[model samples]
Every structure is written in structure tokens, then in C-alpha cells.
Target: MVAEGAVFTTDRTVPIGAIDRWCSALLDELAGVERELWLVVAVTLVVDVWLTHVGLQHGLQEGNPVMRAAIETFGFAVLGLTKVAALGLAGVTRRLLSDRRGVVVPLGIALPWAGAVVVNATLLLRL
Candidate 1:
């Protein structure tokens, strides 16, 4: 089973009208691509802050003594931020490609590298 939020690819069928409606809704939101980018950035920052504190607390409280030495409280926060940044970039790149619209084009270009770095840093380098 795919875990919640786990990234995967699959094919789906939907009516053209449905897709059009969805795109229209997205475009109508908050006026323009710039605002959308700002909103994404703000949300990413907020999530980074909250996830960092929570990950640190959880690691410190629940991990074994040996695990404690391997994990840095703040590092988790950084990792979270990195992931968010990657996703934000991807979103921007996708939007831009769709129509010089948002930041999705740049994001699409950067997200893969960002994700790889984050994964290696956290899982390979840190632990």
C-alpha cells in the first residue's frame, strides 16, 4: 500500500471538463502566479519550523542512547526545509511549463537534486 504522502506514479482517467474546472479553480486562487509562489514559500517556512521542533523532540525523547548521538535536533528541521524547497521548486516549474505561469518550471528543475541531497545528507551522512 502507498503510505500517505509517499511519492508514486500512476495513471488515471478523468473527463476533460473536470480537468479544465480544476485548472480554472487553481488559476482563480489569490490572483496570479507571484502570489501563489509567495503563499507556497510562506507555507513551506511554517512547516519547516514546526517539523523541526517536533522531529527534534521526538528523536530526543523516543530514541535510544546510541541513536541520540547520531541525530542532531536541528538537522531534521533543515532536512524538512530542504524537502519543502524541492517541492516548491517543482510546483513552480510545473506551473511555468504549463504556461509561463508560476514558479513550477524552476522548481521542477531543482527538486530532484534538492531531494537527493537531502536524502543523502540525512540518511547517509548523518545516520
Candidate 2:
């Protein structure tokens, strides 16, 4: 049927398979990022352990309450928790990156590590 000056519309839905493929690609990318993050977490844990050992040996006081407690109690447990937290944060960053809204996530991940490096450097200098 046709009418003069009438507008027509057609269905334009995306295919389910296409959607599935897109999701798979995103998951694959996230998995790659997660693996890289695991390496970063491993390095961070090593640095954390070394810093904690040096800090304890030098009687350094931690500013963070939880870290202070961990430093005072079980340093290895704290290193384990640091790895868990890094992985958890990497998951969150992956989700944010998937959504293309993760401009600050990398910075957030690096800031603490940079701070630790600075503290470690100072500790080394003091030695």
C-alpha cells in the first residue's frame, strides 16, 4: 500500500550471532589485558615484599592503617592481599576499558606503585 507523502519504517535489529561475536572479541581482549596485569601484579608484589622487609628492618612507620597493621603482623599475607587487590582492580579496569571509559584506571593502578618506588628509593638512600 502507498500513500502520497507517507513515511515508512523497516526493522533493523542486529543479529544475535553478531552480538555474540562482538562479546567474544571483547572478552578476548580483556583476557589479554588480564594476563599482562598478572605480570604487573607479580612485579608489584616482589617490590612490595622487598619494601616491607626494608621498612621493617629500618623501623619505618606506615601511613596507611591497614598497611601498618599488615606490616606489624604478617608481611607475606599483605603481599598476597596486594596481589589479590591488583587482580580485582584489573578486572574492574577491564570492564571500564571495555566500555571505553577507563581513562583514569591506568593512572590509578600506577600511582601506588610509583609511590612505593619513591619510598623504596628513599629507604635505599637512607641505608
| Number of the top-ranking candidate, with lDDT as the measure | 2
Task: Please give each candidate's TM-score.
Answer: 0.34, 0.52
| Whole-model Cα lDDT of every candidate shown, in order | 0.50, 0.65
Q: Which residue window of length 10 is worst by lDDT in model 1?
A: 60-69
Which candidate gets the maximum TM-score versus the true structure? 2
Writing each residue's lDDT as its tens digit, candidate 2 over 23-63 gives 67765675556546545655765676677667767877665
Candidate 1 wrong stretches, greater than 4 Å: 1-22, 30-37, 58-81, 84-88, 91-96, 100-127
lDDT (C-alpha) at residue 36 in model 2: 61
Write down the worst ten-residue block by lDDT for model 2: 98-107
How many residue pairs clash per model?
A: 10, 0
Q: What's the lDDT for candidate 2?
A: 0.65
C-alpha positional error of residue 86 in candidate 2 after TM-score superposition, expressed in Å: 3.6
**TM-score of predicted structure 2:** 0.52
lDDT of 1 at 47: 47
Give lDDT tens digits, candidate 1, residues 67-87: 344345544445545557766
